[model samples]
Target: MTRSSHSLRTRDLGYAQRVCVAKAGKLMMQTGQLTPRARVGLAVSGGVDSLAMLAVMAIRRRIVPFPVELLLLHLNPGFDPHNHRPLVELCAGLGIPAHIETTDFGPRAFSEENKKNSACFYCAWLRRKRLFDLCATYGLTHLAFGHNADDLAATFMLNLFQNGRVDGLSSRESFFSGRLTVIRPLLLIDKPTIVRAAKAWELPVFSNPCPMAGKSMRHEAETWVRSICAGDKHRNVSLQHALGRWQLDRDALPD
Candidate 1:
């Protein structure tokens, strides 16, 4: 279908919102995370960030220079009393194809067999492995995640304080010998902007179902980072960049 036809099916998110979306798309393009005819799988978790990312990506495809295919992929962590209807409905409304599957990652991570590793680590690893498998099976060129600037800042702090290393999130990183690349178009965008957009755009966001929600070490780090960046967005951004450089330098060192 033509761009105009596609636009007709999706709601007009207004100029301001469109600008936000365009800004994210531009950032991805500048970083080479997005390219013409790229096939991307969006790893949506039904949270505010992921939901907004999925919508923005779909909208981006309709307006970009060349045709790009997008597929929404959601892996349910087998949390009881959870519903994916909102996500499904949103994808249907946007005319985007989605693949939803349930998994025992959460349970397995919390089970007795998970004594060696923390539940968070095991669950994330399992989910990531499944995502990579899905990308390979579906012929996806890249996998897009919804991590924003705030997430980057928190991640840097987590690595430094918890792991005693300098590391930060990357905007784009290749995986499995470059068979599939992971991209974060929203990396430059802040969480507040994403939260506002999710509300303003009425994204079908849902709360995270993981039992460790708001209680993980990452959560504690994020809270601390949030307090540190209380009224200084620039500080948060600067910290990420500065620490990210240190990480690069660290990686360059010889063992």
Candidate 2:
């Protein structure tokens, strides 16, 4: 569709309450994440962040100039048996195709046999591998994740404090020799904003059933970031600015 046609259609959708969707669309265009006629696979975990991502992408697909196809991929780690149903129904309401997979990654990750690895680590690894497999099987060019700005900040602190690295999550990353690109369009938005967006969009948010939900290193980092940004009104902005500067310097360095 032409730009004018796309604008008209977006106006017709009457999505004024979906400011997050517009912001996500703009971010995708700014970062060159979504190409024309791209098949995008969204990893929806039924959580607020992922559900918000799905809602925004669904709106974007309606009015984007390119012929974009969105497919939902929900991985059920058997943490909760009924968790996948809401995700499936949400996709159906949006008229998008969804693929749901069930695995024992949850139980096995926490089992004694895998005591060497953290449950979070094992579950994340398995889910990512499964996502890549799905991408290859379904011919998807790009995979979209719901890593927001808070996630980015927390990860940066986590690496700095725990791993002796200043690295954080990138908005876009490539894997398998650039065969599949992973994009995080929500990298520019914060968690509170995403929560508000989820509410405004009426996303079906599901609670994570992981026993280690609020006790990981990431959680500690999140608490630290929040406390640092608590009293100072501009602390969050300063951190974001610092991250941007660091990214520029990092990009300019040798590979």
Cα RMSD of all models vs. native, in order, equals: 4.4, 4.7
Instruction: Give all TM-scores, in the order shown.
Output: 0.86, 0.88
List of clashing residue pairs for candidate 1: none
The local distance difference test score of model 2 is 0.79
Best by TM-score: 2
- Per-residue CA lDDT of candidate 2, range 1-255, in tens? 322123323444334325667767766776677888889999988888898788778778877787999999999888887777776656666778999988888898989868778888988899999999999999999999998878888999999989997798877677889888898877767777788766656666888888988998899999999999998868998896677545534433234
Model 2 ranges with Cα > 4 A deviation: 1-18, 244-255
Cα displacement (Å) at residue 155, model 2: 0.5
lDDT of 1 by residue, 56-80 (tens): 8877887788889999999989885
lDDT of each: 0.79, 0.79
The 10 consecutive residues of candidate 2 with the worst lDDT sum are 1-10
TM-score of 1: 0.86
